[model samples]
Target: MPVARVVVDVMLKPEILDPQGQAVSRALVRLGFDGISDVRQGKRFELEVEGPVDDDALGRIHKIAESFLANTVIEDFTVRVENGDAS
Candidate 1:
């Protein structure tokens, strides 16, 4: 059976400071990657569904992202379905 893959990308809010990302940026510059001005670290979650994705499933996934995958106060997230993601 085919499976549906949903991706949730979570990131710190723009106003929130990202020390980890800053450190990476500095490291990249030291390693000869000078063109990069900045970097921001985030998280990704991939969820597998047994059937095709629908509006109701999307809504449920969004709720899961809001409640468990991301911090609403300091982070933001986006949910999207992978068109051809296969294991």
Candidate 2:
């Protein structure tokens, strides 16, 4: 079997408050960077998987995101399979 490449990006919901982001924005303003309004922090993951990748595996990955990788209550994630290989 070949390898499957996947990428996962997790981001906080737009409506949610981010204190760290706000702090960065304020610091930028103090540093004379004008018109910089907002900042948000997010996580990205690049993964390579062995064997075939089907819907079932994708579902499992989603569950992993929900259970471990992301805080589902405040964030949402998107998963992309970059390359699919079945050899």
Candidate 3:
């Protein structure tokens, strides 16, 4: 079996509100940073897996994202492999 590294980015949809990011931006403004308009927050996931490189593996990864990794109601996720994965 081959080893694979996966990097996933999960982010809230544009229509969704990001209170934590908003608060951070506001704090930045209060600290004298200017011209900052909006802020959004997201999550990053990194993992290693063993599998063949194929569409079925990709689909299984997506299912993992949908089942446990991402909040489907307000967020979307993207999956990518690092260039040197060798799997």
Give me the candidate number with maximum lDDT: 1
True-structure lDDT of candidate 1: 0.94
Clashing pairs in 2: none
Q: How would you encode candidate 1's per-residue C-alpha lDDT over 1-87 as one tens digit per residue?
A: 778899999999999999999999999989998889989999999999777689999999999999999999999999999878355
| Per-residue lDDT over 1-87 for candidate 3, one digit per residue giving the tens place of the 0 to 100 score | 888777778999999999989998999899999988988889988767798646787788888998889999999999887678354
Residue range 1-87, candidate 2, lDDT tens digits: 788877789988888898888888899999999987788888988777788778988888888888888898999999889854543
Tell me the whole-model lDDT of each prediction, alpha carbons only: 0.94, 0.84, 0.85
Off by over 4 Å in 3: 85-87
TM-score between model 3 and native = 0.81
Q: For candidate 3, what is the lDDT?
A: 0.85
Looking at model 1, residue 66 earns an lDDT score of: 99
Pull out the clashing pairs in model 1: none
